[model samples]
Target: MKGWKNPILLVLGIGVSNIGNWIYFVAINLLVLKLTGSAAAIAGLFIIRPLAILFTNTWAGSVIDRVNKRRLMVYIDILRGILIAIIPFFNSIVPIYIIMFLTNIAGAFFGPTSETYITKLVPPEKRKRFNSIFSFATSGAMLVGPSVSGVLIMYGSINTSIYINAVTFFFCALAIFFLPDVDEKLSSEKVRERITMKTIAEDWKAVISFGKTATGFMIIFLMFQFITLISFSLDSQEVTFIQQVIGLSEKNYGLLVSLTGAGYVAGSLAVSALANRLSIRMLLGMGSFLSVTGYLMFYLASPQTIPLAVVGFIIIGFFSPFSFTGYATFFQNNVPVDLMGRFSSSFAFFQAMVQILLTLLLGYIAEVVTLQTVTVAFSAIGLLLAAALMSLIFLQSKKALFILEAENNLTEEG
Candidate 1:
């Protein structure tokens, strides 16, 4: 526990920020609806986040890799806090959207920067446990944040919730300020290189070169990303599917969401407790396969089998942390820490682009075809991808990748 002080602090900081993010999510939707009285306006808020990611990630990596990540994280959090704090002052929808866009742009940069920082801070042997604890914090926020927002809005106002969220970001910045500067030893020239068009181009080339040279890693990465894309597409339709197809009430849906959060929290705790017991391959392969099966169970369930759907949700939520933590550990151990930011951002850029396209396509298809049919088809696709991912994960030739000590030794030898 003594050895975990800094990592634990890092987790707490992230957890606080996540709670604020969710609170802002609910408040912003209501605020947009109040201002414009249009569902489209609220929907536009959703588009702004991924659009911001697309706009920023192309060059964000160049800056992320060259800067002191800890300082960059502090600045980004403060910037987001300021942007969110002023959101309540905007009576017009356009201005609010503009502010939200800028805030998300800051968020886009922060994601990769934080990932790189985490990789540098947490030792390889401890990442699985660290990530499990991180997952627990995130899942707890998922449960608590919205409920807190509801209370704030009910007792106070939407503005109150927004202001509180802004404060959380500032709190996150403060927490980040206390973190050690892991980049202190990095070469001065590397850190001082001004971000230029040429630097950005070279970073992209380096990412491409890594992808070509490390085909297995890229394949696993993309397959896992595709599975996530499926999950996101399914989530976008979850409300409609539960209400219309499964004949569940809004209250039931809310309860189900709460249950999912509980499941995630429980699963994260289990992973943390059993971190040393479970191998990375088992966590990645079995965890993902079972999660997909849960999705399958839910999708195939009827109104008469609502309990089955409930169980399915629990299963998916519980096992998802296993897959996520496993992948984070795998990624941190495998990717060079120096290139972590660029690799994360570059892949995220493509993932965001595909997510936008896939989400739109799923929405359209659900309208054209039956929602049930579309969801089932996508879930089946997810199952196939998970199976393939598991197969790749357990391959003998790739076994070294999942073993941290062996991989580190191999890297040293190379």
Candidate 2:
């Protein structure tokens, strides 16, 4: 806590970028909807994103593990700024899709690389608290961004909103420039020893070997990721379910989405303020349990009692901070700095793979079955999965904790 200025400033920078990302997200969806007038185009975004991540993460991890992560972060942000700026100029839908896909490739690398930088910046003991703060910042953006984008599109202009998003990325890059770069938490000699001439395949083999030694931790991590994957299905089908199934108008549905965001913001702030007091286990346990409850609440709601749907979504949003707080702590505390890049990206890659398959499968299911039926059915699956996830986290994690500690000790002593 002695010199917290830099990390706090960095968090502010991240918050700006997070808000901008969400703004662009909403704006682009509206843009596409206007251009093509097709719900399918909006859904195509989910497909385009994970596909980009799948291809990029296959090799991004290996490069991230070897490179200077700070410099990588700088370059990616600058390029992202450029990419967002380019989007406004494209008149054709095809060009927009291509640019969006390229932008995603940059984002895929930026995700784990920034995480690696944070590991080197924040100490292990404070990571849970830090994660809580960071998660709160992002949730706040999720709360604000879409509403702002709507106002901009309605009153101002979509082009103006896109330019604002572009500017935020440039500001983010500028803010990150001030933070001093620490290549690794390890000593210079240790980092030098880690640097190798290995090919991508060999670096991945190293990653595979490390994963084998702590299979239990990896399993826990993947379960958390899988839970997240199932949660995303709601986002993809939300509009259709609300309009077609529940018979809400477009404006009313937007209000419901805003309400969900409000619930999320409140939940995030609650955990952020109490992060110092809550243990990681408590966060994860409560989060996992409530997520299932939220899913079931919405699933079980009668079409006439749609307010219950609001309550359900709010419950899910409120628990967002706690689950992510536990997840970030679990990763930062357990994973060694030397292998953090590959480990995090490998997890991302696996998560992306599941998301791709699930998104496709769930989309197909929604088309065949009624959207409402698919929503509730998937919620049933999420409920069971959440129960299993909670059990794994709470019931049988002693051995996993020991393995993680052993691995951490080895990295530190190396």
Candidate 3:
């Protein structure tokens, strides 16, 4: 609590930036739809996001540890703000897609950089609480952002909504500008290391070596990556699923999304309120189970019960605090702050690679097969994956218990 100045400001900036993102998230798709009238184009944007990450994340992580996080964030925010602002003026699809892709490339730098900054600023003891609060604030923004965007589009224009998003990004930059520097010890050698393909490869090699030494950490990391990979794959098709199969309008889709955001807020607040009593196992394992179950429900949803999608989304949203916040704390506690950037960004690189391949494949599949069938198949597969992950967690726990018991016995004999 004493040295919370940096973390607080950082979280504030993150929340502001997230609000802007959610605000424009749907609007951007609608903009593309208006231009091309192709759901495939919308899904194509999802692919672009991961492709940008794959192109940037490895080098971004390698260099992040050598740089000033605050300055980097501010610069990227300004760049993204400018890019987003100009997006409204672009009448051609090619220019719009290019701008969006570049904006995401800039954003790739911000995400890992911000995560590493938070790890440095926030104390391990308070990390979980801070993340819960951060997530809660972000979710609050999610609840209101799309609604605001929708209303602005209804009363004003999509261009106006996009401009609002642009403003928020600048606001975020301003907010972060005042934060005291939160950084780790930057190596002289690191500053000299230029960004290159070799740099990424070397960093990944180091990450692999580090993970090998800590089997438990490696397992948890893989779990996180796999879950995200599965989720993002579905995300590429989610909007299409909502509109076509579920028979919902754009406004109703936003409404149901807001409901899920409300659930996220509730879940985060509950975790924050009960931080003292909750154990990581209960939070991570049980949380995964519940979140996955909610996803399963959505995957199995029918048009007759389309209205019930909100309930499933809410349930999934409700448990995110446990899975996301728990993993954040887990990583902070286990990984070195010096290597945090590399560990995070390298993992993201892998996740992006997985998402890129899977999203393209799934997108192709969705074109030929019914979108609903694809949705349910993937959702059902996600459920099975969750079950397998839980088994891994169970085995890891048993292994730890056995090691602890052996240690105790050895101590007693001595």
Question: Tens-digit lDDT track for model 1 on 219-282?
Answer: 8888988998888988898888899989999999999998889999999999999987887778
Say which prediction, candidate 2 or candidate 3, comes out ahead on TM-score: 2
Which segments of candidate 2 are over 4 A away from where they belong? 184-198, 397-414
TM-score of each: 0.96, 0.90, 0.86
Q: Which window of ten consecutive residues has the lowest lDDT sum in model 3?
A: 405-414
Q: Native-vs-model 3 lDDT?
A: 0.77
The residue pairs found clashing in candidate 1 are none
Sequence-dependent TM-score of model 3? 0.86
1 versus 3: better TM-score goes to? 1
lDDT of 2 at 371: 73
Q: What is the C-alpha lDDT of each candidate?
A: 0.88, 0.78, 0.77
Best by lDDT: 1
> What is the C-alpha RMSD, rounded to one decimal, of candidate 1?
2.0
Model 3 steric clash pairs: none
lDDT, residue 134, candidate 1: 94
For candidate 1, the per-residue lDDT at 59 reads 93
Q: Which consecutive 10 residues in model 1 have the weakest lDDT in total?
A: 405-414
With a 3 Å backbone cut-off (N, CA, C), the pairs that clash in candidate 2 are none
lDDT per residue (tens digit) for residues 280-316 in model 2: 7778767877866787787667679898888888888
